[model samples]
Target: MIDLTSIYHRAADNYCYLFDEETLHIRIRTKRDNVLEIVLLYGDQYEIVDHQWITSLQPLEKIGSDSLFDYWQVAIKAEHKRIRYGFILKNTEQEMTLTEKGFFSFIPEDSGFFFCFPYMHKSDVFSSPDWVQQTIWYQIFPERFRNGDPLLNPAHTVEWGQEEPSLTNFFGGDFQGIIDSLDYLQDLGINGIYLTPIFLANSNHKYDTIDYFTIDPQFGNINLLKKLVEECHNRGIRVMLDAVFNHCSVEFLPFQDVLDKGEKSLYKDWFHIHKFPLKDGDTINYETFGFYEYMPKLNTANEEVKQYLLKAAAYWIAECQIDGWRLDVANEIDHQFWRDFRTTVKAIKPDLFILGEVWHDSVSWLRGDQFDSVMNYPFLHKSLQFFSYDIISAHQFTEDLTTILHSYSDNINQVLFNILGSHDTPRVLNECRFRKERVRLLFTFLFTFPGTPCIYYGDEIGLDGGNDPGCRKCMPWQEEQQDLELKDYIKTLISIRKETSLLTSKGTLYFLPAVNNCLAYYKQKDNQVVFVLINNSDTEIDYVLPFSLSGKKINLLLTQQEYAAESDELSVTLAPYESNILSFYI
Candidate 1:
């Protein structure tokens, strides 16, 4: 008789299997102190009876306080379908592969089992009909925005001299500030605001979440968030909060309970632990990548933890009525957790915008299961690498850009989030060595290029900063008196981007050969066509159009400059940092 239920469990170094009395449920159990590692299920036995053992990574040292973990899950519904799988572990000198004699086998190449988690239904989600298909988004870090509320200033605990220039430190900035600055953001022509983590966090940056249910008091109360949402909606702006699900603060109730109770904590199952790091009842395990022990990582592998955070996210969406989320450090967490997390958030708020923070290509996330978008760090990194690193050749630079865009699947490519500068990096102006022209050329490319464009606060006014605290500097309201031209130029770019469908539309492109160091590309969408050219070289170079010219020619919408295209190739020139956009009607 083929059993209908089966489970495969792997301990710190062993495997356990369990079968239901009715043979309809298979249970796999493995425990370390108080934590459980893997619990998987199978619908039928005959479906996947013959399978070999594969590979598995050595269990990570319990970074939190618990020893339990659930890395992946498999659920088969059909009665006769069988899937083979196994586990292989290798670290340094010791390597071993083992097969369990229970239910369906785990296979590394099989993606079907990986996508088993629940997903937000398409209809209920808030994605535009073609949201990800054709989108150019702009991200706004709220605190540095306009200060709308004088009541919501951050309380300074440490002096500037005492404050370590590290991410662990916090600077007070809030939601009221975002509302007061809507006009400034609107001037930049962004469709959405992917604000950083705004949940009730203990720190100023808000990554160390204290309470998922409430908005941070420093950032303003929940009421302030509602007002911001209403105002943003009033102006056709979509708002997405930052979701830092990978961990919680040490002050969080679950983690606190673990610390208080030691080994007998009821919430001990919520974290991963091999052996308690505490020697004399002192909390030894601080967190994943933290200098201090206060910020603890949440065990996403736990179902209750998953459900709790998902519900918290849903509550905010329903109560506050925000659009979606920007997941923090998405790559470090388990893929299944995000899959289920995405499903839960979408189920609560369809059309919800989900973006992830990954420093490189996240195509694996876009496989129709996890995130709607990811911070286009890959593009941002490459662009900065080209200008700041100067190690890459022009050919290599262009090729890298092309490769990134081409790498994404169709659906993922549409909602790609690109940025010039963000809260985490040096402002683009400084990254370009304070050269206004190179900056201008970059702006031309940024606004013209595909994917959503995110502008870190103060980038428009040419704010200069090197890294973290510097990047998070106060807005240059006072300096605008001297840099009005740069401000106006950004406003113009925003205006043109909003008005032109060709610039915003999603379509294929043809790269025109470089004129000297000038590179150009044509963005065509049906009857609308736009030609963008940027000259980064020291001297002006004449550029000739490569496409057919049998059409009505017009001036560039942003600069209001006109050019005639008589032959298939037309002569156009750009000076240092000079860029132009020529529109044509076919």
Candidate 2:
């Protein structure tokens, strides 16, 4: 047995290692160590593979102080399978064991290493496409968005002892509804639309999926969806449908059949069943998620079920021409399924983006598998939690924002959807007591900060609601009662975001300063440099510009307001929740 207890060391400067059955690639951290060669050994006989050097590390940083090195990566094919493997330094004639780690770490057979790191084994189970990195998505709850076609509305009364509902209960929003509003979306500069699950489901919110293949009758049939996709494609917009693979409704055909006939049912193997409730037919004794009772969890471990889901996903991409998917409760489902699903989906279309619904750190999902990005709830949650005390100081906000940025992985940090509030939470304007100035600043940060920004529907018109059902209210089309100032402010911001290359194009973010209840940050890409400053203090505060960033600080937006930068200090007075954009050449 390979000794699992030993902490084998690579060279002190070696930072990266990639090994499959055949080859082992090692990367040196510093440029000085780039000349070293690697040797793999087994049973006193050694196999040597020459190192092919890639470019040196772009920016050099001291690691501890022992060694200096550079990167060396090579692809190799091994002669025989070796259990006990170690590497030797070519120049120094020194050897030490290299234990496996990371997403591809191999497990020792006897020690139950697989059980200990079950999730890690499940980490590389999927491969998401690269386009998800560039998507600026907008999530819309169909019931609340708009009502286009009235004919597709389900009858108020159902047949054979079915529950009946009024038209108000079902707002009659359909596929055509979204189709009619493409111009509005295009004008707003949204690239993608992430509609909630439109599958055949019972609830107004389609979390309870009844059929995997069919579109909900209330939301029009499959044909309508295809048409909608075509129209959206014509307008240069991509559509991403929500996939609730975690659970199915009790009324779902499979679940209902299982409930009707205990073990004898054909779909018995699909769910995790032990016993059913005696009073209300047979209730399956299966493990379910924490959300609600009606939503029964699917057995993704079953290969047949896995294939069916993959087929359905492929059907949407191939048949409906969807550009991506927003996976619901992705963490709760089987890891292998995600891996297989990603592979299968990518095989169908390499550009299909998969966004997972992970509320916390979703690094494992975003690492070139399963998902390209997550909902970014961590950013919104922390930001809102800090500002819930009725006021957010600029320094506190900046610190909190920077902490979130650094915590995330490089891929997710840049592509994350920075949303103020979604259908799941209270509206920001309502929570901030209808303070339009603060709302304006928050939206400004959302559009300017790292990652793709999303705007919750009706937020631009100052819609206020506290929680779910209320927060997910219908679109207020009453033009006379709208917040014109807030709407105009949002329009201005949106226009600027679409027109300005610095705001739209991604760049390296650098923190400038956070002093006297004011914060400053800069984004640089190519020749464009945009400096964002936010003042959260009650009284007017003067900002002293950094000496290094002096000369030609032109006010990009507020041109009427005069500011001066001379002799190392740029003094400008800022009102409460006032923000400014200072454009200059680097």
Candidate 3:
């Protein structure tokens, strides 16, 4: 058997409370070279008898592996919220039982030998807002969305949709524009709007924040924001504003003070400065987000900075009654500040959502104390690889998705900010090489899959662009320029999503086997099931439903067609780039 002496630690990230007070999530790590399967034996601590242990066995899944170790995980629901658990690990050579005491050849007779979770408290459970599951989010890059109030427009603003966007250009999209578009958004059936940074900043994107307390004049003031929030709430839409706390613009007051006063500045500790004289040359004297010298990284570890940002967070929620915050470059900041931020914001509004922008695995910030969820960039990457690039097969896509699903607990997976396109990336339509049919298939998969789905602005109407300045195009207001069919299709999908509970975050997802280049999955919640099928290839294919689904009445949600399965293997033909969302009673 492999040596188990080096493995240890059952702390926060390794073991966590998931879903509710009764559920516990645990992870174990072993040397990377070992090929071992682990089974957990767990039961109530009080259930042990004399020299006999009454326990249940659960096999752990190997969720992830890196260069140094393999990580195994499992989630167990203890009825009493107290658990005594031990691992039974086996390799090709021998098997051993591991507990708090040590590894042994047989199970320990005493309950004290097992590892114990004292109690899973309700307050410690990781949960997002209840309203999140029901939300279909729309991401808006304000500078390009619309120019409702031209008086608030920037001096050099160009004609809407006439000129291509540049790094310095602004098209005058503001809060009033969003207020004016509330009817359009309501008609589109989305209940959540995620607006990129609206705080005072130097650039058009507002990512390099100048002042957190004030809204940019180009985007309107606090009054406009309040009115926009009220209007959105009136239309049954929740608003989430972007928080750019990781860095600040060079022109920011504090940063300007630091530049003027150097080491003598009282605000010197707010930023990370490397030298006595702050220089603006290509070789940066201070630490920055990237190579850009203007966007200096904030010292989130500083106590004063922490309180300042936390207060700003509390101000937005308490004053405007916003529903959530989408943290920008969240991974670079220290986790402690985020914990404080969460406490500060949730104290004002307990259910306010906190979403972090993390591109990779965010297990560290996703505990009960910090962020509620993170941007699902991995989902976008895998989906694009399969649908846009056509590099990976359907089976590989399913396997990749399964790995992502297993990486986090079901609770975190449910509220993940799943997005196909955003301001930073190329438009989804452009990624698909302008293939409307491919875009339709991707949309079908996005809506039917588990998690809260988000659409970037202008995506529903088939806006096409490349990266950065290209993706940030002016939203076309003219109906003749819009793809009404695509918009209507997206609206239909949203309507179906809102009406179907199984398509929401509460549903349990399962991947069904299908032919090459064809992907299929089923989501089930209680008695209702939603089966989704997508054909990514250029040729037609026949898909056979599992034997368990035979003799059931299936209702196609989009086409409004009904069919009755006749045999154990129900066959359906899908043309190239065609997709389907079928609902049935089980």
- Best model number under lDDT: 3
How displaced is residue 275 in candidate 1, in Å?
1.7
- Which residue pairs in model 2 clash with each other? 22-78, 30-69, 30-70, 31-69, 33-69, 125-339, 126-339, 276-283, 277-283, 545-570
Return the TM-score for candidate 1, rounded to 2 decimals: 0.73
Q: What is the TM-score of each candidate against the true structure?
A: 0.73, 0.75, 0.91
Model 3, range 1-586, lDDT digits (tens) per residue?
5777655436355354455666678777777657478899898878757757679999987765444566677879888888888888888987888888888999887878888888888887878999998899999999899898999888888878779999998889988888888989999998999999999887999999888999999989988899999999988999999999999999989899988888889999998888878885656788898878889999999999998898899899988999999999999999888988988898999989999999999988987889999999999999999999989888778778876875677778888999999999999999999999989888988888778999999999999899998999999988998999999989889988988877775534787765868998887667777888899988998998774667789888888799887766777788998887888877
- Winner of 1 and 3 under lDDT: 3
Clashes (backbone N, CA, C under 3 Å), per candidate, total: 32, 10, 0
lDDT of 1 at 178: 74
The C-alpha local distance difference test score for the whole of candidate 1 amounts to: 0.62
Give one digit per residue, the lDDT tens place, for model 1 in 1-586: 2112222344211121111111111112222232233323222222333462332222322111111322222222332323233433333343332344323333344323331212223332223335543344555655554555556666653332233335544434567667777786676666677788777766656778888887777678888889989998898788878888887787788888887887898888786654564334655654453545666677788889989888887898889898878888888788999889888887887788778888886756765578777877788777777655566655556656655654553234446777888877888888988887767767777777776676776777777778876676656456533367877887787677767777666444555545565667887777668888877677877877765675457677666876666666667766676778888866
How do the residues 1-586 of candidate 2 rate in per-residue lDDT, one tens digit apiece?
2222322234211222222224323332223443244443222122223432111112112211112222233232333422233333333443232333311122222221111111122223222344544455667888667777777777652321122222235667778778888887786666778898899887878888988899998788889899988988897788889998888888888777877887777877777765654124444367565746688788999887788888888888998879988899998887788888888888888888777888887656654656667788877876655444445655556556655654443334567867898877888887767777778777777767777777787787787777776676666667675687777776666666656667655334666557776767877767567777777556677776553545555555533343444545556567877877776664
Arrange candidates by lDDT, descending.
3, 2, 1
Model 1: how far residue 89 lies from native, Å: 41
